[model samples]
Target: MLAPVTDHPDTAPLVDAVRQLRGAVAASSLPLPVEQVSAERTNRVELLNQLDDYVLPRLTSIDAPLLCVVGGSTGAGKSTLVNSLVGDVVSRSGVLRPTTRASVLIHNPDDTRWFADQRVLPGLARLTGAPTQQDDPGQLRLVASRNIPPGLALLDAPDIDSVVEANRDLARQLLAAADLWLFVTTATRYADAVPWGLLQQATERGTSVAVVLNRVPVDAMEEVRADLAGMLMQQGLGQSPVFAVLESRLSEQGLLPAAEVERMRSWLSSLAADSRARSIVIRRTLDGALDSLTGRASALAGAVTAQEMAAQALAQAAHEPYVRARGEIEEGISDGSLLRGEVLARWQEFVGTGEWFRQLDEGVSRVRDKIASVLRGRGRAAPVEDLGEALHTGVAALIASHGESAAMGAARNWRSLPGGSELLADDRSLAQVSPQFDERVQRLVREWQGDVLEMVRSEAGGRRTTARLLAFGINGIGVMLMLVVFSATGGMLAGAEIGVAGGSAIVAQRVLEAVFGDQAVRSLAAKARELLLRRVDEVLADERARYDQALGRVELDPGAAEQLDRAISQLKAVR
Candidate 1:
């Protein structure tokens, strides 16, 4: 958006990114893991959209300062400390996991430029105060305080990792919006994994940071401070200063050390929230945001790779049953039998001249001629016992030719497709499995036919094919003559003659092709694709359900991991 409109692609979506963060903050809706992933995708997409619409067009105008957002885990005194520093409860603070869902920005009136919410009217308490389509009176409470300064805004973030979950994310967005961090953690909270994780994030991107160790016990202050500071150094925040808010000092002043007490006020007042410092914070914060986005992009790349792998695994599993079924069907098609003794019975009828005994002399003569040709040539049309035997030969040949390697290769390939781990059917499914007929499914069908045709290459084999043709002629007459003689009108030619007519031999071939050719193949492919689709849906749903159960973690910012250095830096700068 910024690229085309302003002849610069870089600045286009900056405002949109801000708005997305702002919306995510306002919505306070948390998602399960899958939903979290979805939300992340949504957030990134929205940010890109914003850069085009709001940021790029205003590229010539967006000169705002950094907002140093102080966020933390729930019960980590995020709000209490904010109030203590600002000398008032600008944000509601409590012991609940989520004391604040909405983010509070504290700064002097000079710092007002950074507060861009359309809700802020002159002397307004909050955005909720602004009359608009979506308004809630109760939501408008945190007064827009003016004590911070130009180019600098102190953000009271919800929590880096809050069980309320939404607050955790509120903390994340606020972090992204900050130029620097006044990261706070008490002696007890300092050791937490969540905050450390966030601190590490700040260090990685070189965000100018300061840490405050609030409510430190008097007895263990030195030890805790040293250990915490050491950990921060290890996290590469060695230059960061740490400030200790002594618990005993708060008690002597008649206030809970963790509360908005006087000393905390004094320490916050000592920091220069003036124009120069504010400018530095603004640049640093924007750079930090860019770094964080880059990090997020890396995480998404990993997710896409995993998704692709899973999809491939599923495809292989679906193909297995399809391949096997086609192979079996081809064997059946070749022999012209489906669990029947018809093939052998028909062949015997033709070979033995079973029905020819009733034929006229001329018909019998034709039969004899054909048979003599076969016997003398040792024709390839040797009589078979049954359809079962013919089918067995082709099937055996196919399996033997492919061997175990082919079977294993198919199974291996299936592992790359989804449900690969579970494609092996149980006894019940195996029993119900049936081979489907199709001309294209398996090349074996052609092989089966070709093998049968092989014998017809020689004169002897051709003689056999001819013998079957002639024998059926004689029997066909015998049966028709009998039917005619039995007819009431003396019309022997009127009734059906033989069960297996000679002329009908060619017609049966046509019927087989119609059943097993393109029509059957198409039908089978559609069914297979449908079955696989159903299975894919089931697997994806299960994965998403598990992610839903884990939605609680979605709000954790990848940053809270560098508290010691931030604290050390703040302590050094203390008055």
Candidate 2:
């Protein structure tokens, strides 16, 4: 039995700190598909189970009955031991491999209030009834019996090495929730790997544990007990009490003989009746659990740091390729590369050749009249519209090609990354440019062409150059301006293409210079170039956003690790 709650120091601050730590752990997501990430995730879940099922509840209710969870390997007779301890069949025991399906909590009727609520192991659903063979392992069955003492509760947990994964997980959770573990093992199976693994964990966490060496041959009791005791000493559990039960036939009611469990039963009864002794057991387990938190929480914090690094690396991998794509787009627009094929031929037809050049050197007024007369004679609408279409096609194709390349580059980089292949597998569309990309690029070029025309209209408004603009036609001048903007950076073209493309740019520039002076034409080209690049950037950014969305699915809160560290430090201080 525990003393009054006031016998212990106030733990409100410690509880609050641990709660904060739990929140941080819960918020630190590890969704990336990496090798170390899976193990770290398991550690995170186990830590959370310990805090929720035991630490927080025990801190708040220091006077709750001692919960001695009887847990061990498969076929270890844990259920039979629990029944024999209480001197009744509170839990079923049989030859079936897993006799205990749901965990059975047997408490004295007077202490039912403590076990009936959600204070401890709050995640499990509670069912109150006699223990049954059909119990669901997902729930906790509460059985109140006067045969058990008030200050102690025996919870029969599932086998530690149950073939069902859920049962194995539930067994681990129940053990973590215990104030004391009554670990049971048969003499024949005492050195099994699975039960010893859990014992090692108990040693690390400092949980109070006792061993039950059951079903030893009567003549071999001394040998097995001594060997088991020596093994416990080697594993740092020397102080844990060990009880030996010899192999014997069961009574008609399937209960062990009264003499077989007398010593262990008396020990539990005395431990429960003595408040000081009970407090020692509780405090020892509680302090050990608390002491283990700093290292465990720190480990979890480190895992969060790893997750953040992985996420950043993935985002960067997706970002670099788009950055290069933007640079390439800028180069294509400014290096006179876009003024090839259809655009160049269309420009020549729209501006004519020898006579148009001679006319440009004439007076501005004479040049304007000749340009208007020749355009009207040639029926200039078709030539102007044809040139506009050619420019649109060229710019659209330039942006579309680079956009596709950027998508492929980002996808390829992601496949080479740790978790990237899985993400790409989930969304195959990310491997290529978006379905609407070409459509957007076409609209972008058309909108930019419209913008250049508007600039022509705006710059020529209320100026003497308005006549030259009208003579050349606003559409024709806009197309000429597009040509100049394509090659605005000067000298990227080389060899024969440079001469043709370079001469075409010069003709477009002189025509614009004739209308809007040299400085104004240069200003218009600069502004137009800036607008086109800005639009291209917007298009490519949308493409980059696809990768951003994928990364967002696995993103962790960047501050989760620091918050966990602070919580652990505060908990240590309060303790």
lDDT (0 to 1) per candidate: 0.44, 0.86
Q: Per-residue lDDT for 151 in model 1?
A: 43
Best by lDDT: 2
Across 1-575, the per-residue lDDT of candidate 2 in tens digits comes to 22322343777777798898889878877788765888788888989999999998998888999999999988888888888888888788899777788899999999999978899999888988676666778899988999899899999999999988889999999999999999999989999999998999999988999999999998889999999999999999999999999998888767788898999999999889998999899888988888888898898898888878878888899989989988988888889988878887877677665455555556645655665677878988888898899988888888898899989999999999889999999899999999999999999999999899999999878586566677787888888888889885446667867767876777788778888889988999999999999999999999999998988877678899999888888877766
- At residue 302, give the lDDT of candidate 2: 87
Q: In candidate 1, which residue ranges exceed 4 Å CA deviation?
A: 1-62, 107-113, 116-142, 248-273, 291-299, 320-324, 335-340, 346-365, 368-575
Query: How many clashes in each structure?
Result: 55, 0
With candidate 2 superimposed using the best TM-score fit, by how many Å does residue 420's alpha carbon deviate from the native?
2.3
- TM-score of every model versus the real structure: 0.52, 0.93
Off by over 4 Å in 2: 1-8, 132-134, 353-376, 465-467, 488-492
| 462 Cα displacement, candidate 2 (Å) | 2.9
